[model samples]
Target: MTELLDIFRALADPTRLRIIALLREMELAIGELAAVLDQSQPRVSRHVRILVDAGIVERRREGSWVFLRITRDGAVGDTIARAGEWPYAPREALVIAHDARRLAAVRTERAAVAERYFAEHAPQWDAIRSRHVAESEVEAAMLAMMHNRRLGHLLDIGTGTGRMAEIFAPTARRVTALDRSPEMLRIARAKLSGQGLPVDLIQGDFLDLPMAGASIDSVVIHQALHFAQEPDRVIAEASRVLRGGGHLLVVDFAPHEDEDLRALAAHARLGFSDAQIRGWFASAGLLLENTETLEGGTLAVKLWLGRRRSDEDQPPVTQEGQGQRKRLAA
Candidate 1:
């Protein structure tokens, strides 16, 4: 069929295939897609239009910008699977090698673009931080949950800029802000210290926190869980530091069909769904008190509120064969 041939022709190019791979996980604006492909905007747009006409990609408008993502068509999936088997002969290997080099160069350019973006925005992070947080209902719910809790020693995991910590410190006796980035910690320290709040700054990984067991009365993680290399281990660490009856508040974007975030953010997994967060909490010896979906339109946020049970009441982790009861100690 002419349509089928169009699909094949669109995918025959290495650049179009790379775009398909990127769109398989996350929807991207045309400019963002262009940046990733290291191609001119017009060239990327033309390729995307070809793929769209072939029913392999779909476009949606968000405000003035248009986003592209893979179509949810079985035929498209089949086409992709079949295309995976294009046998490249020895001569074709040279072309593949050339393309590999080209892709590497493109990645370097994209990385430079990302670096410039972060660098430019880093200075004004505080001014715009609230805009990002305030836009989400999940953030609001998490803030309300923290407000209602009788927090004594609060620990904010991945506390970039101390935004959540500064918010919690006035109500809690003390707030400890932890982050892996020294630059981010410096910004957080400046923000929290400038407020004259009782906030302690620590630089460390969330999975391997420097805090002692049962040291914190509350733990808050805000839009940062997806960036963790080991989310389960980080949750376990949060459980370990939480005192009995302590609360854990998590706010993050719900999992979308985006694979690019998984690759770009070093995300071990896509953002958590409600069921996944609940399971993680149960495994960490924490009881789920509430889970809610915050309406943020296309950027849906999920909030999970959990409480640690009494230390002795925690579940036991069973070994595969030994049948030994290893307390699910965080």
Candidate 2:
């Protein structure tokens, strides 16, 4: 009863209601909310705090910017989620319509900034792409591999420019795009907004993911593992978060003699080999299910599909199982 009253109190204000409406459309920063509301930043933050304390809003920080969205959990969140369906008074309707127009302007501003960043970084990305098979071909192959699988909770590690998250969001129950670079996440936020799916952009390291164990149903490390100083640790961390039978798809370069990439692109490793990847998978208790190789230009890209071994997939912990394990170790 107290919680219900707190929720009602949070929504009792006009500005708070407007903020909720805007968030329902897409995630917005406090500054964006202020711009839409024609209020000062401090005032908007106070309203945000009220909603957050009521469990009606959530705040996610990526770099210096904090993004706000409607919370999609619990009974209060579900009830407030239906605010979009509630009939508003004539004045409320007009105000919402006006806010929607301002929201469009905010979206335009975000797009312009994102475009500038892309233009500045396009050459480096283009150089790498020029050396690999066409991105379309790579994406097609990935789709075919994941076509029949359920992408329950998809995590895209090192989600540079959010391409993988954007590509897989439609099929995923929830998508989390994580990157170490805040600039890249900003660019990704611009790319993944309003995709009609719940996409969360997080600033995090792949070697130590900020997720609980066995929480993810699928993971995609797309063309990003070569940047890792310890790719094996990255694989191990990914496996830790995967549920039983969950999938991990790694798309990266096959072993190559590209020394220039090391200096020019900040690549920690030149490329990877089949034996190295298979060994890493086995060490992490994952089974390598299938492999696809795409060759073009000077570099070749390989996709290794691995599945986490469930208890059912493992031998029972019996005397026989111990002997089998001993033999495998030998």
Best candidate per lDDT, number? 2
lDDT of 2 by residue, 223-282 (tens): 899999899999999999999999999999999998989877999988899999999999
**Model 1 global lDDT (CA atoms, 0 to 1):** 0.73
Best candidate per TM-score, number?
2
Q: Each prediction's TM-score against the native?
A: 0.55, 0.95
Candidate 2: lDDT of 207?
90
Query: For candidate 2, which ten residues in a row score worst on lDDT?
Result: 189-198
Give the TM-score comparing model 1 with the true structure, all chains together: 0.55
Over the stretch 117-170, how does candidate 1's per-residue lDDT look in tens digits? 568776555442332334445545767766677799999999876788877888
